[model samples]
Each structure stands twice: as C-alpha cells, then as structure tokens.
Target: MSMYCNQCEQTAKGIACTTHGVCGKDPEVSALQDLLVHAVMGLSLYAVEGRKKGITDPEVDRFTVKAIFTTLTNVDFDPARFQNYINEAVAMRDKLKERVGVSFDHNSANFQPASDVAGLTEQGKQVSLDSDKETDADIQSMQQILLYGVKGVAAYADHAAILNQTDEKVYAFIQEAMAALTRNDLEANDWLGLILKCGEMNFRAMELLDAGNTGTYGHPTPTAVPLGHKKGKAIVVSGHDLKDLEELLKQTEGKGIYVYTHGEMLPTHGYPELKKYSHFYGHYGTAWQNQQKEFANFPGAILMTTNCIQKPQESYADNIFTTGLVGWPGVHHVDGHDYGPVIEKALAMPGFPSDEDNGTVNVGFARNAVIGVAPKVIEAVKGGAIKHFFLVGGCDGAKPGRNYYADLVEQAPKDTVILTLACGKFRFFDKDLGDIGGIPRLLDVGQCNDAYSAIQIALALANAFDCDVNELPLTLILSWYEQKAVAILLTLLHLGIKNIFIGPSLPAFITPNVLNVLVENYNLRPISTPEKDLEMILG
Candidate 1:
C-alpha cells in the first residue's frame, strides 16, 4: 500500500483507503500530512514542557492547533501547502526546543526531516498510521481515537481563537495529549483515561467556540431562510466561518451582488449582525456531499471558508475560491481578512437570472432562543403535547445508508421535536415537520461548531423538568463522518451520555475490544432502522 487513510466515514471498502483517499486525497499529499502530524507532535513535546515552566507562547499554541487541523479530512489536499507546513512545524519545534532546554529520547522528539518534499514524504511513510505494527491493536485504536479527537479540538480552538476567544487550559491539554502519544509507557487503561480526557477538553474547546461565535455575531435568533435564489449577481459562501462570511457580506453591500449561505453556513443567516445585510440571501444547496452537483449549477462565485471542499468539477472549478485553512491545488486562495477578489469574481459572473421562491427552512433555534421560550416548552412537555425530543445530526457524507436519517426524521411522530445541527441536517432540512403547541418541530441549532448550544438546550430541559438529562424523554440519533464528529462523540461520553444511537456505520478504526469498551461503558448502539430504533427508544 502506498498510502492509508480512514479518517472519514466513506473510507473505501468499509475499511481503509490504501492507495488514495476516498475523499480524493492522493498518496503524496497523504504522506506530507502524516509528516506534518509527526512534526506537530514534536512541537507539542516542547510545548508541554514549556507549560510546566509557566511559559507559554501564544504563537506556538495557535500554530500547533492550526497545523493539526490541516490534517483533518477534506481540509487540505495541496502537497506544496503541506510541504510548507512541514518545514514550519520543524522550525517551530526546534525554536521551542531551544527555549525549553530539555531533550527527550523518543523518536518524535528527536526526529529530523530531510529538507525536501520527497525526503519528507519518505520520512512520513515511516511514521504513518500503520508504522507501529508492534503495538496492541486495541491500544492502537485508542491512539487513533485520541489523535482524531485532538484534530477536532484543534479545528474548534482555531475557530475560537480567530474570534479572540482563547483559553490556555485548552491549549495545555492539546499539547499534553499530543505529547502523551509519544510515550511508550502508558498501558491500555492509561490510554482509555486519556481518551476520555480528550473528550473533557473538547467540551471546553466547544464552550469557548460558542462564546466566541455568540459574542461576535450575537445569539442566533429563529429566522427563515429561502431555499431559492433572487435575480442578481451573487456569491455563495460555504463551510463554517462566520467571520469570513461577515467580511464578504460587508464588502458586497450595495454592489448588486447577493450573498447566499451553503452547507453549514445556513445558520449564519440567523445572526443579527449578518442578517442585517439586505443582499445576504438564502441557502443554495444541501450537504457538502452534494456540492459537486449543487456548485456546478450555482451561477455565482463560491467561497469555501473552511473544510468540506470536494475536488471541484471542471465546470465550476474556475468559479470557486478557498479561504482560511481549506485548500486544493490550482484553486485560488483568499486571505480571510479580505473579500475583494471574491467580490470581483461575483461581479464578473452571471448570478441568478430570475427570482425563484422555492420556499424556506427555519434555523437559529440555538440555546438562547430555545431557553428564552422555556416556559412554554416546559408546559408543552408537562402536558404531553411534546412526547419526546430527538437530537439528530452529525457530519453528512456521500455514502449509502445515509437515507436512514431522512427516513427516521420522516417517520418520527408529530408530537416529537427534532433538534439538528451540522451538515447532516441537510438530510431532512426542507421537510415540513410542522409544530408542537406552537413550537416548530424541526429546530436548526446552527453548525457543528454550535454543538455546545444543543447541549445547553438539553440541560435546560432537564433542569426545568427536575430530572437528570438521561431521564428526560430525549434521544440522540447521530450520524458521523469525520474527526469533528468523533470529538463530539467523545464529548458526549465524557458528559456520561448513554444510549446514543449512531450510524450509518461505526468508525473503521475501532477494534472489537475497543468497541466493547464503548458499548459496556456508554451503552452506545448502532442504528438499525429508524422504525425499529424509534420503537425501542419510545418503548
């Protein structure tokens, strides 16, 4: 095998992708990504030491998080970009090593890269996920879980830091966890403990991100966004960055160009600061998986602010631009602070030729909005007007068996409320689930970044009913696709959440022993059919 990647749900053959990634990542790029992760692990070794000495470099903290984020699925497939990141990671690691005045005997701490891309790629192969064939399969599974969870944390931490929300403890845990991966002394129990710790820290990371988003954009309010387009020059913004969307919205004002949200950006329409822009129109497509078709038909410039980028089809390849940490070779890259190029592209293109009222989807039922109407919600639940609550969302993917989510939502009883977040909601976002006692049954709780909001809503309901959250008539039916979903699952486990029904499939990385650990401790189960699971859950 020239390469190995199974970080996402659609890994080839329900196992690993050996030659190239199912997500279009080639072997050379995969090698560089592996090298980048190894380099960051070295830097983390010193960063962990620095924290013990009461010395922390904000630059190191920020770079460490951002570098780990780049290795996540579909974030970057550019070999040159990864090459540059590899060099930078080594330089940062050496600089921190000089300051810490400490040495480790481990290979991760002392490893040096050859100065060229080919050399680095070769070195990366030595440290690839399969390199450690001597370790126990269960321990290896735990390591993958830990590493992937940290990747998710870094993504959120980077997003939070962008909005000026920084927490040193979060950074500390990240460095410590990465550094721990280099240790050969830890046992299975030790790895399990660290795995749960990763989840606990993710909770903090998500909380900080929540504060950053709401503090910057104001709490999301329930808003209706159109599913159709209006006649105008247009730009469609995808991914999860509100700041980038805000910059574009600001630049496009009075320019006769309409700005639309795509994928997870749909929830940004509920933000007061963003929605004030008259031309910031509505959503344009479904989940990220469907973007190849959706983007081809979109007659406007597309700006992808974060991950979830598919290889652009030739038809719309020239019309798409990537900003922030997301990148693809040959695609134009924009600095997050500026939107002039994107605006120019939109102005040059022919946007919607006519107005189309394709109806609307309601979003922004975040923690604050839902909690604001707590009295009515409590009354409804107490009177049995709302029989149950279902939190059903995760990263949406291109794989089969995903229709199970749509079927589940469609089959859910009318008296139940569905709270969804992330791109997974695209499965049934347009369905008219109607309302229960004046409360809309289908509630959009912002992006996956806003998982914190969903947790708060569940907690608030539990408090009002004077029962533990597990005792409430609430069920978590989740679908996962990537590292972010893994991190969120760990967070749920850390919070002692049980009986979570997750599908279209379980992660390929989990060995049966590790699987049993989760099953025994958390009561985690795979989804059967929505009908069977709902019957079991309701019974």
Candidate 2:
C-alpha cells in the first residue's frame, strides 16, 4: 500500500482513500504519483550534474515543469497515465546521463526507500528498505513541504517562460531542490532550511511572472468587463497565461469569433494590450473548480492555458482545448504559441450564432493598477465609504466544507471589499455582491501565486492609513489545497504577517506541534462556520 502512495499530503496514519483525498486525489492514483516524483528527482539530479560540465539546455526546464506539474492535485488522477510520465522522465534522465558521460548505480546500498519495511517490502518488488535506518516523520514532512513548494515555483517559472521570461537561476534552484529530496544524509534542519529557501525562490519566481505578464501585456488596469452577452461566434480562454490568450485574441481577430476571459483569465481584461481587443468578451465562470458544471452549456469552445483543469465530461470534451503545461488524456493540446489546433477546434465546435449575446465581466486590479487608485481608495476609507478589506483567496477544491468560502463572501458586511487571487474565487465570483462606493465588492487578482499582489496592496493600504498591516482594516481568510499556498504562507510568515484564518481544515501533514507553533506565533486559526468567522473578522 505504501509503495504506490507516497505523495505529499498523503495519509500518515494510513493510505488516503477517504471517499477521496482531502485534495481530491484517490489511493491507486497516489502511488503512480510517488513514482512520478521519484523519477523527477532522478532527472533533476542528472540535469544538475550535466550543467556542471558546460551543458546548457532548455529541455531541463521543460522536463522539470512537466514532472512537477504531474504531481499537482486534480491535474493527473490516473495511475497508469502517471506511470507513462515517469517512464518519460526516466528516458530523459538516461539521455542526459549519456550526453554528460556520467553513470549512476541504481543498486547502490545508498538508495533509501521512501516508505517503511511493510510498505517497501512488497511481495515481488526488488527495492529494499535500509535495515539500519528509520526515516523520521518530521524530516519527511519538511522535505515534502520543500519539494511541493518547488513544484509551485516550477509552475510559475513555466508561466513566465511562456511570456519570454526565463531565469536560469530559478531553474537551477529547482534542480538543486529536487536533487536534495533524494539524499537521505540530510538532517531535519537542512530540510527546514531548504523549505525556507523554497519560499525565497518562489518569491523570485513570482517576480519573474509579474514582470513577464506586465511587460508583455502592459500593466493590468481597472476595467469593467461586460457581463452581458453580445452577438457573435466566440471562444472563451481560461487559466493563467496572458501570452497565449493574447495570441489567441490576435489569431481570432476579425474572424467573427469574439474572445472572453474565464477564471484567472479575467485579470487579462485589465491589461491595456489585451483589453484593446474589441472582441474580447467578459468573464464566463467563477473559478477553476466550477469548470465541469460551468462549461456544461457554454456556447463557445474553451481554451485552458494552464492548471486548474478539471477532468472534462464527454459532453464538452470535444470543445475543450489545452495549451502550455496543461494536458488531459484525450484533450487536444495546442503546443507553443501555434494555437492552430485550438483555432481549428473552435471553428469546428457549435459556436454561438452571429446574433447570440456574448457576456461581459469586470476585471483588472493588479498591483500597479490598484496602486494607481490608492488615493481614491484611501479617500474612501477616510470618507467611511469602505470600512474593511478582506483578502478571501487561495486555491479551490471539491471538499464539502469548501462551500464555507462562498457563504462567507455572501455574508460579509456590505461595507467591506473582497480582494481575491488564484482559483478560490469561483465560488461567489458570479454573485451580485454589489459595490462599496464605485468599486465592485469582489476583485479578481489573477492566479494563486498572485497572493503577492494582495500582500502589496495590503501593505500599501497600511502605509496610507498610517499603521501596520495588522492594525489596518484588513483580514486574510485563506483556503489552501496545494503547495503554492504553502510557499505563499511561508512568505507571509517571513514578512511577519499574522492573524490569518485558514481552512476548511488544517493540513493533514502538519503535526500537532507544528500547528501549535504556527497558531501561537501567527494566531492562525482553522476556519469555522461562516457566520462565526465573518463576525470575528467584521466585529
């Protein structure tokens, strides 16, 4: 049971198969997950060693992103298909080793099985457990945290690369961290330091993505995307990559296929270059978690530019197109900026009639754009038009308790404003929460990693209000499902931001003592009923 199920956030008490994982991952699915991570560690080691000998290649970054992305929640749930990714990683490792003239003895006694005796000593498997050593659960937990953090970093790096923002140092750190996870000699402190380092590197990764996005698409500014539909045949592009969406808008220009933003793509509507597209329609869905239901009856083809892809049902499968690192078993992948396949598929789908109404959504409140509104926002606060700022954001999942977010947003005082990032906002994004003054109640702030932007906005507000961030009329209510949240949380800690409310449950991987440390130092609390949590924040 242990052999196949060794991913981060896996069941420590036993294998995770409680209806489904807390993150929606199943058991058989988890084992193939372990294999993929193991294979990536091998590939990263080979790539790092190869670079020492004057070898520089882009494929290393590509392989690193693919390997790490496969381990993300809800990205790949099929064990058999995951093993294929592992095989591909092994093949990449072998090819890199051959080019670098290096050989690794897999049978060496140094290799330590990640699981215990009962777990590793399966009936017919050749991998053996180390007889003299027992892996410490704390150390393992720390290592997993670092690895998952790096995975999040890799995802951001991939996005930046798509926008022509490549950082060699970032890719090198990815290789370094992946290779470190496989070494059994490292101590707990060493792993802890690496975990912190992962946070620091993620900061760099997010900066790169910010530059890539703003530099290419122009800074996102305040723009009201029309939620009402207009007449046209259109295509809706979702997910995080503005570059791909820009290219698609360009390709489909004047072709009668209007483009609309969905989910994280809603932020693209704020960019000067992207918003200039007259055919660019408004947002379609709330968040990635709602894709299956939201896309069920959409009138146009959908293009997923990055993660947060739900397993598509047969009804809309043919209409779903993917680009960049996102892929599904049967979906058509539009590689590079080619987008030929996506264009062709959109044309082939039963698009909306010429007279059909294309809806509109309001977006664009990124750092620069929001900072531009600082004077007015501060004036409103002084004028008592807006009372508080609520950063109700993070990753979204299928857990039953997750609906608390939607309910919490619904119940927030009318005087409060919501600043959201990542995929979590899908819950109440479509709700007519009304506005405080002229500002809409809910503001979409791009991808999950864009939590950085929310941080900047909070700090700016505090500076304007002449107080520390905590002293300002601001609160952070976060929902996490994956490592990007881990990295972002660490950054908040590094900055001494405290009193965060986190839920639907504490991470299963965080030991009680670690939870205590976080709670005592940061005043972190698990989310409870929306009525109660809202009262705590609003009162």
Candidate 3:
C-alpha cells in the first residue's frame, strides 16, 4: 500500500516496487513521485490548451522537463522536493490558463492536490498508468511504453536544458503526450503510432543534447583515460553531467586535488576543453552500479552528479555529495554549481598515496570523431576488412542477467567492429579487442545520451554504402535499465531501423499483446544467449 513503481528495468522482483524502490527510493518518496506525476499530467492538460492559444511559457516548459525527470528512478528521493514541484506545476498550469484568457470546465484544469502527506497519498491513489477503466490490456501496455518513453525524454532533455538547450517542440510533445495518457479514446493502433512519434521527438531531444554537450565542451575526441588514481587529494565525480564535472575540475585547479571521473563521467575526459585540465587525473571506477563497493574502498570524496546513486554507506557517507537534479535525503547538494564544499571534503580526505598501473580504457568516439575518419572506415568496409558493425550500448545495472552484453562482445566475430556508448560499455571496454587496420575493433561512442553519435555514425555509413541503415551490416543489442535507455530505444525505432535484439529482458510494462505488435512489426526480440543472438544477427 505504500507505493507502486516499476518504471525502471531493474524493478524489485522484476515487478513493482511496493514498500521500497530498488534504487533506494523510500515509500514516501515513491508515493510523492506518483502524486507529482499525477499533478503534472493535470498541468499538461492546461499547458496543451494554452499552447493552442499561442500562450507558452519557457519556464513551464523547462519545469515540465525537470519535474518529471526528478521522479525517475535513482534520480531523486525527497518527498519535500516533490511537494514543492507539484505545487509549482499546478501554479504554472493555472497561470498559463490565465495567460491565454480562456476558461473551461475540465476537471484537470481545476485539479488541486492536498499539501500534506496523507492528502497527497489519497490524491495519488486516484492515478494509475492507464486511467481508462475500459482500456484493453494491449492498448494499456502501449500507453505505459509511451508514458515511460516520455519520462525518458524528460531525463535527457533536462540534462540538455541544464546546458542551456531547450526545445519548445520537445516541451509541447511532453505535455501533449502526458495529457494523452489520461485520454480514454486511443486504441491499440493509435497508441502504437504515438510511440513512434514519441521516438521522433526523442531523436530531436537527443540531438539537442548532443549539440549542447559538444557546443559546451567541444566534440569529444578519442583519448585514453587512465583507470588508476594519482597520489594526492582526489574527488571522484560520477553520473552523466559534464558541466558539473568541468566546474568541479575548474574549482579544484591548483588546490592540490586530483579530479577523477567515475561512471558515465569517464567520457568527459575525452572532451578537448575538459581534457586540457592538468589536475584532471583519470577515471576512478567501473560503472554506476558498482559504486557502493568501489566508493567504499576509495580514499577520497565522491560527488554524484545524477542518477543511479544508492544509499551511501556510513563508511563514506560523510564524503558523498549530489548535484543538479540528483538527490539523497541527507547528502550535501552542490548549489549554484559551486563545488567548494566537495573540494574541501576532498582536501580533508586521504587520497591515493601511490599510483598504480591499473591500465586504461579509451573513449570519445562520438560522431565528430567517428565521421572524421569516415573515409578510412568506408574504405575498410568496401575492402571487406570490416563485415559487420554492432552497436551494444545502454545503462548498466546490478542484474545477473546483464552479463549478456559482456558475453556478446567477447563472442563477436573478429571481422566485426563493436561500437558502444553509455555506462554499459564498462562490461568489456578494456578487453583490448585490438585493431582492424589501425581502427580499434571496439569504439566507445561517448555516454548514453551520446547514442546520438552512434545514430549519426550509422546514418553516415549507410549513406556511404548507398543503402538504408538497416540494409548495412549493423545490429543493435540495446541493454536498457532506465528511462534514458527507453528514450534511446524509441529513437532507434523512430529511425525505422529494425531487427533490434534487446535484453536482459523487455520492459515489464509491455503486455504480451503489445509485445507481439513490436515483434511482428519491428522484429524486436528478447535477448537469449549471446551465442544464439549473435548467430542470428551475424549469419
């Protein structure tokens, strides 16, 4: 009765998170998130109406992206924050109505939520993924997919917004689609079409972020990042935010501290502007899911810039920090992009006393990097030196089923090239897949949002080959865990690429009937053994 959440791939027991979220979200926090989503959907009803009157507010658009983003798993877990967001969402909705100078009797426009915990829970009880009492199970499944996909869009767009990239169309799509969720008229086919359209919007969202990141820090370059630490005071930064990491590195300059990238932040070092920092030592650990143990054993402070932050262990909880939209109940949150608190914590903590040769992993094969060598890659493909390209990327998790990604890379044919993005590449990124004519068989295409890079690379290759991207020798085995991954998957579908094999499993929200539509139309397959899926893909 406390909560009901299953928005992420690694939901508790592969179903709903009732009592506590697997991502460390408490029941009250989860309930608040539910209430907040309910409130936002109501706001979207009016926002959609006001937009038709040509009354649009960028702040409401920006807030829409952020408020839903905060509810995503591992992103935020503060009930108070959700309450404030809910109140603001309503205020913005009502204000937009007044701005348009129109009045309607829709219950959603007049919706009001209780300010207290008990009242919020009661309000949330009236909301569900499929509000239509008569929706078909299959149609409802597509509805969930669409809803989750929008949440995914919000997560990425939120990051892009922080970097000062916001699109009015993306905002309009978010509000329009969230309001669509409350509708009772859409059938199975209608919902499926909405899914594809959402994918198209997500593609634009990803492109905006790609531009945001590259514009802010320059396009990522291929660079070798040291996996070991330097002997000095250090601050380890995780998550996918480059702006925060750059700020921390800027503040820590000449302060006798080394800034080590962790999790998805590892790719930040490949940016020309960021890599130029002398005190930017190297990477600190593997993926986000391993942070608990890796962080516990680390010698310095840790700053989590985004999601996948677990409950900090008491051993190093005092040194753990959060920034941007990420939150933990008691952890210090960096305000105004100031990293002084984190720097002081790093200064007080004992960092690595001696450097170790922990090897290195290469990254930053983004679009500019990959396309820069297009002629070389194209010649290699034409000369038959490279027969296949596999894009295996997405969020990494603690699930035992996630081993398939590592296994697929190991089992890939020697004549093939593996192009990966996101935290999932940590599985076999350092395995030394060697080279095919000076081109490393394994190419790291930046972070999860940078899947935009992979998509661009695919399109360029397809253009060179004079064929559709799917007509080229390419297969995408996406390993999804959270909403960002959902957004990316939808982007791929939107591009009309088919025959994607996703695993460790499909989203629990996909009902059997809805899954059938995906299988029949898109040939989406649940990943089996790597041996089997690879054989199917390669042969």
Query: How much lDDT does each candidate structure score?
Result: 0.91, 0.72, 0.85
Report how far residue 133 has shifted in candidate 3, in Å.
5.4
Residue pairs with backbone overlap in model 3: none
**Model 3 over residues 184-301: C-alpha lDDT tens digits?**
7777778878898889999989888988899989998889999887888988989888888888878888999988988888889889999999999798889988999999988888
Candidate 2 Cα errors over 4 Å, as ranges: 1-15, 18-30, 46-58, 76-88, 91-133, 353-360, 382-386, 432-440, 465-468
TM-score of 1: 0.99
On TM-score, who's better, 1 or 2?
1
For residues 1-539, write the lDDT of model 1, one tens digit per residue.
Answer: 38988788899998898998989899888889988888888899999998888778999999999999999998998888888888888888889889999988777678887778788889898996668899888888999999999999999999999999989989999999889888778999998988899899999999999998999889999999999999989999899998999888888889999999899999999999899999988999988888999999999899998788999999999999999899999999997468788888888998889999999999989999999999999999889899999999898998999999999999999999999999999989999998987899999998999999999999999888898889999999999998999999999999999999999999999999999999999999999998899999888
C-alpha TM-scores of all predictions: 0.99, 0.84, 0.97
Question: Predicted candidate 3: what Cα RMSD to the true structure?
Answer: 1.5
If both were scored by lDDT, which would come out higher, candidate 1 or candidate 2?
1
Candidate 1 ranges with C-alpha deviation above 4 Å: none
Best by lDDT: 1
lDDT for model 3 comes to: 0.85
Q: Tell me the tens digit of each residue's lDDT in model 2 across 1-539.
A: 33332233333343334344544465445555655666677777777788899786687677787678767665655444565665577777777878888766543212333333234223113321211146676666676667767778877777777777788888888888988866789986687677767777777778888888788878777777766555666688887777888889889888777787777776777889888888887777667777889888777788887666777888889888877666676787777688666667666766655444344445677788678888988888899999888888887776668889999888888888988887777787667788877777888776785766777888888888889888988889998877778778776766778889987777665666667767897898999999988788777
What lDDT is obtained when candidate 2 is compared to the true structure?
Answer: 0.72
RMSD of each: 1.0, 4.8, 1.5
